[model samples]
Target: MRVLGIDPGSRHTGYGVVDGHGNRLVHVTSGTIAVPGSLPFPERLGVIFARIDALIRQTAPHECAVEDVFMSRNAKSALILGQARGAAVVAGVQAGLPVFEYSALQIKQAVAGFGKADKEQVKQMVRTLLRVTGRLSSHAADALAVAVCHLHSRTSPLCRQVGEQR
Candidate 1:
C-alpha cells in the first residue's frame, strides 16, 4: 500500500509518501509545501489545496494520513491550523483517496515507542525507521512519522472496519 501523510500548517504544510506492506515501510518522497506569508490567508489556502491536489494525482496514494489538530494555547493559531487541515482534507476527498486522522501523540507513540517523545527523538526514530540520512525539518519528519504510524497501525480493527465498509 502507498500512503501520503500530511502535517498541515498555514505557512508550511509537510507531506511524505511511503510504500508499505504489512509492517514494513519504504520511503517514496518527503517534502514541504511552503505558502508565502505575504499572501492572503485565502490565497495561501488555495495554493495549498492546489499543490496537494496535484501531489495526490501524481503520487496516486492508496491512503492518506493526517495529523489531527493539536490543541494550542493560542486559539488563533489553532484556528489557522484547522483551516489548513480542511484544505488538505478537501484535496484528498477530491482525489478520492481514503483519509485517516491521527493525533500527534499517536504518531509519536507509534514511531518512537513513546507518546511523550521529544521532537528530536521522533525525528531520529523516523530517520532510522526509513533508513535515511541527513536532517529533515521537524514538520517534514513529523509528516513522515505519521505515514509510518499508519503503515504500522492500518491493520488494526479500526482501519479494517473502515476498509470493509468500502
Candidate 2:
C-alpha cells in the first residue's frame, strides 16, 4: 500500500510518501510546501490546499495519514495550525483517499518505540527505518514518521479487526 503523510503548518506543510510491501517500507518522495508569512492566512491555506490536491493527483496514494492537532500554549496558534491541517485533510478527501489521523504521541511511539520520545529520537528512527540519507528537514521527517506509523498500524492484528468492523 502507498500512503501519503502530511505534517501541516501554516508556514510549511511537509509531505512524504511511503510504499509498504510486506515488511518493507520504501520511500517514494518527501518535501515541504513552504509559504511565506507575507501572504494572508487564507491565501496560505489556499496554497496548501492546491498543492496537496496536485500532489494527490500526482502520487495517487491509496491513503493519507496526517498528524492530528496537539494542544498548544497559544490558542491562536493552535487554531491556525488546525486550519492548515483542515486544508490538507480536505485535499485528501477531495481526492477520494481514505484519511487516517495519528496523534503526536502515537506517531512517536510507532516510530521510536516510546510515546514520549523527543523530536531527535523520532527523526533518527524515521531515517533508520526508511533508510533515508542526510539532509532531511524536521518537518519532512515528521511527515515520513506519520506514514510509517500508519503502515505499522494497518498491519497490526488489532487494526485489521477494527477495520473489519468498519
Best by lDDT: 2
Candidates' lDDT values, in order?
A: 0.88, 0.90
After TM-score superposition, what is the CA distance of residue 31 in candidate 1 from its true location, in Å?
A: 0.5
Give a tens-digit lDDT track for model 1, residues 52-130.
9999988989999998888999999999999999899889988988888888888999999999999999999989999
Clashing pairs in 1: none
| Candidate 1 wrongly placed segments (more than 4 Å) | 158-166
User: Across residues 22-130, which tens digit of lDDT does each residue of candidate 2 receive?
Assistant: 8899999998999999999999999999999999999999999889899999999999999999999999988988888888988999999999999999989989999
Each candidate structure's TM-score, on Cα atoms with residue i matched to residue i, is 0.92, 0.92
Clashes of each: 0, 0
Candidate 1: lDDT of 137? 80
